[model samples]
Target chain A: MSTTATAIDNKKGLWRGGVSPFKASYGKLMMWFFLLSDAFTFSTLLVTYAFIRWSAPAYKGEASDFVFSTEYWPIPEKVYEAFPGFHGVELPLVFVGLMTFILIMSSVTMVLAVEAGHRMDRKSVVKWMLWTIIGGIAFLGCQAWEWTHFINGTEAGTIGDVVKNGLWINNYEIHGANLTFNQYGPPAFAALFFFITGFHGFHVFSGVVINVIIFFNSATGMYERRGHYEMIEKVGLYWHFVDLVWVFVFTFFYLI
Target chain B: MEQVSNVVVQPADRKKIWGIWKVALILFIVTSIEYVFAFTMSKGMLLNVIFVTLTIVKATYIVSEFMHLGHEIKSLMYSIILPMLFIVWLIVSLVNIEGAAIKGARGTQDFTGSNGATEQVDEGH
Candidate 1:
């Protein structure tokens, strides 16, 4: 009849419904589950992307010998060469690489914030969170520019005969990607690009918004008054999950 | 109602902080290697295998080090990762089956034509 701590400890109340078997708080556990579901969502999208690309005829010949043709799937390096401010330079994969670096750095800052929060260092949390926000916005900016280029496309008017880096200059006059057509090989190419990257971008956008809220909360000493910074750690999980998704996206969407 | 915060605030752990930077460095190095392969290595199955493997490595570091799941109990880690392993298996097999089916049915035909020519219809708008 002893309902004491020693009794519960000795009894191993793991399945007795008084302990967390996973050793994680309820909020953190739920966040992990949510990320698992999100991982499924992203995996399906990328899998679909791979399926569609695989079904199509792959570009044959050397990578450098690649060309834009409606007859075959476009090589990724050929399509993603346009860099900001250095237009017309065939700097393949550079911009997206920079974007990846930005997201990775932001994730690092978020972890630092969580580390500072463990010590209830409000000042460091604010500083690191602010940097994380900046990195997210910068990433979004890069995405916006990339989307514009994809949508607007290279000067639309040249005849289809003029092939630049494999893309026909005048394919139906309206170049780039849109709701109905894709100048980059197959329609699914642009469609999947927009859908997958756009979905990931939305996640990044929401992550930034949440970071801002956490930043405000930490800045105002909310956690200080409450005596713990568990909230930062939870959000840090979400922020890092976003980064994890990007690592896969960078590989599947761009690198492959 | 005031909810009691039972969590204890610990002092800064410099070793843990340094460990984080080390993981970050590892991630950066892996990404740089991918970039180098992307440009220097030609596109093929070998390059793809390298990229996918590196990506998984980066993902592991993020989930383990940054998300701190690596420090969690074994049950929790397995609960998350085991399901993911199944999901990945499903995706790989399904994508292969579906992709092969489509390719077999189409046989390199120019199906991209006309469907991608919708711009001609919408040009006036």
Candidate 2:
């Protein structure tokens, strides 16, 4: 009779109040809390980007004049304008568009994985997570290509002769035989770009690692034994956060 | 134990998937509009307002639907968004301060024919 009463009490406790389907273990809850804090960190960085862009001195010259391949602060589109096999043509924002699509598709795959988890379909979960990881790798590859293009000036002309206006004019030269303020608008721009993107990329890399581990576990039926796929759901939250951050990056860093 | 079984047995309406898809479609449409506006419109005061508005709309959908913040308790919602208000306040104040500093520097440069050091020395020891 005592055991029956205890069982009844446990049952009553389960739904006495509103309960969340996502109420998992403590580790999962803590992960959500940590992600909330991390979200604030990224927001601070992006807000700082807005502040700096607003505070910078505006030059009357055209954006192409003072951007990449010159001694001026890079115009984002010019710096990231790579499109394979269409060499020597200045097509703006093509690569960024591709990167955005990759990220969105990865996000779609992540949702599919989460849906599979809800259905307790381990095979589907693993399959979709693999696709999501592939999407992440593709994005990282695109970023690497972008970084390379940025470091090595395009064939428009040699590096030092480029001016603030995307023109490869002959007169402009890096003072003191090295590129400095005269070539780039300010050192802060490049420094911030590398730091922010590098930090975000690091997050993506870590996310992929976590996803792979989860995939392996699911494939081995570890989660099935545990009777839930909450781990996948927790990781999905992290993946979505990464995608959210990239949307901001696309808008602020690329389009703006 | 009984209530746990009941909760598990309660079938979630599969129609919720359609609602999720609707939210996603709205987000995509808004983002596409933002892209179009950005590419076609010249940068100016009006464009800035429009872009910021559209961005907020997209952010709203992501936060509410994708993040599931809408399903959360009202207090939790306030806790998250209230801090963001403070961030917005800080951004506004800092931008104003920086703007003032730049204006002051430019004024000194225009009047003194130098970057303000001579004026400082003349007024000081």
Off by over 4 Å in 1: A1-12, A156-171, B1-11, B109-125
The DockQ figures for the candidates are: 0.40, 0.15
Evaluated with DockQ, which candidate comes out highest? 1
lDDT of 1 at A192: 89
TM-score of chain A of 2: 0.79
lDDT of 1 by residue, B1-125 (tens): 14554545567788988998999999999999998898788777899889989988998999888999889989999999999999888877766788878877765443333444322221112
Tell me what fraction of the real C-alpha contacts between chains A and B each candidate also makes. Answer: 0.65, 0.09
For model 2, report DockQ.
0.15
lDDT of 1 at A248: 90
Model 1: docking quality category: acceptable
How large is the C-alpha RMSD of every model relative to the true structure? Answer: 6.3, 7.9
- Calculate the i-RMS of every candidate, to one decimal place: 4.6, 6.6
Clashing pairs in 1: A68-A166
